[model samples]
Target: MADLFVAGGIVTALEDAAVAVGRLDAALAGNPLRRAWTFWSELDAARRHAGADGRKVDLFRLAAHLHGLPLRLGDTASAPERGREIAGLNYAIELRSWMAAPDREQQRLRDIALDSLRDCGGGQPALVATAQGMLEWLAGQGSRPAIRAAVPLYLRDRGITIHRLAAVTGGDSLRAGPVDPDGFTVRFLETVGREAAEGRDLLLTMEREWRQARLRVDHRAGARSNSRLPAAVDLLAASPLLSISALAEALGCSVEGASRMLEALVQLEVAAEVTGRTGRGARRLYGLKRLLPIRAETTAVQRRARGGPRGRPKRVLIAPFAELADDAGVADATPDAEPAEPTRLTAASFDFDALDRLIAAADERTRGVRRLLDRIARGDKPFPTADGTEEPGAA
Candidate 1:
């Protein structure tokens, strides 16, 4: 709450500065306007207090810089684009820095923020905040119900619906409460791991009916499946190229099954299908393709605006050791540089192409579970016994 208060204060301060600058610009343009320097004075005072790493302070500075740029340019034709460019640049860099921090879930959630920003076309601040909140929650979570509840609130605030959130997080409201928190986290981790492993989305679903004023579930899919797919998706995620047969072979399913899986992914509006399907049983390929590049660009730009590394090692430096010191006995010992850290892919570096593949896998999994549940509910398929034997279907 204190953090939120501080964040809000920063925004209000920036808005005030922008307003003052607008008046100043008008006066310079010979348009009559009221004078106001209070904002400027307050901003200066805030800057002095902000010290370093106060992102809000930086935002205000950028806002001031941009407010004056349009006035100086005169021909306002490109002002909107310039403003958007500035915002994107700052967001990308800051987000990247945040992802590189010590916490792993924070990094993962930041990736979710970047992808959400891509879809929303540059509005990711809320997503960032929500993700931060959720990650903080995850680190200290103790109860299954609490964890499940927290995820929905965070995702919903970030503009994701219950179903979409479920598709991404693989949490089923019906079973979320009774499950183990550690196991739940593992399931989520596994789902993402499988996604990383095979380049596919993790998905979960369940069926429910009301009985005597209470909602009762008729069928369910457990959390164990969530972690399995990420492993599967990771294997397929690397290929910039894909084919139906290749996917089918990877998924261990028939060509028709793979095709259906791909189709379901397309319906979720997550994965992109590459054009050119072959006739006479030809295989189709898919990629993690998103329609807009602005989000990706914005992420990159934010990193630059923040004046920090975007987490990916751009280059490696190497040097040779001149002398070996066994016990500090050798003089002028030059340190031999170790190999550069292997570049780990962050959410910022993910090709939307790979993300789409995960989304595809998630879709396929959702459909499979739905079909099985539907068949069971309708008496078309038999229920399995405790010993794993299926009973005969209803007549």
Candidate 2:
């Protein structure tokens, strides 16, 4: 809770988390091993839920940096490692998507990531290998309609280690393996693990319902599957966050036609415009309801426009290490330095005092969140009433 609050711009959360963890750390001071274990578990949960790692493309770039693998955005002569690592990460992520796809295709992509990992050389070889192992395990699994997710692999210098993530519940798994003990590894594990069952059901359910939605569209609009709008639905179902330009090209129609089809879906409540760009020439993205993050944070950039506190909360971007990897001259940035600490994820570098304060704020929010949850449990809504009074009262 503290990590989420802190990540979401709630300083109280950080203070609260620090305090809570400090107390726990002190309590378990007698047992050093247990203390470390608990600390790592709690910390990992926070980062994973907050998605500190980032999206698939973000992860590719992140891994390349963390492991000292170079990636270029130019046409200049790039090192062989740069291209190999980038290609490897891309294929690795693709393998995760194929976990629920056809078996033959999944195997094909799995081999690509493995071979790429083998070829690329730089820092954090163990981390790269561990990630490869996880992807290999997932690719080898039976074709069950599971949620597509990214798994964190430790790329720290020394040894390769995968996170040994347990199932959030029974029968939800992505081939278990050895894991690196850290504050952030478990966060990634639980985020993906807890969603495993739901993702499976969601994929299966969508497979059935999306087909029904398509059939309904065909029946009502009298459009064939191969037609502009109908064909585009297939693409939307596959990759929900689609652009007007991409849809237009896929449908072989004008961009206006693509926009029209999307608008039609919006009217039917089958899709929603995530970015509210309205100009004909402006950039935009459309996504299905299922693709949106569950209980997503309302960023400061998204003001209420109506009634609400207008205070800006600071948002923290997780930079695992210093400016060493982000440099364009990553190849010559610095001699590969083995991390001194255990890759502690408090990106702000919290000392004991800062952690305690952050955790204190977190404790208060924790109680507040619990109260809100209790209200929800009692069948109350978390919105305002007609009079704009906030409470668990009648709407």
Which candidate number maximizes lDDT? 2
- Per-residue lDDT tens digits of candidate 1, residues 174-211? 22332543344333433322222111111000000001
lDDT of 1: 0.32
Q: After aligning candidate 1 to the native by TM-score, how far in Å is the CA of 199 from where it should be?
A: 17
Show model 1 residue runs off by greater than 4 Å: 1-149, 152-342, 345-351, 382-395
User: How high is each candidate's TM-score?
Assistant: 0.20, 0.32
Report the lDDT tens digits of candidate 2 across residue range 281-302.
6555665544332112122123
* Deviation (Å) of 57 in candidate 2: 16
- Worst lDDT window (10 residues) for model 2? 161-170
User: What number of clashing residue pairs does each candidate have, in the order they appear?
Assistant: 31, 25
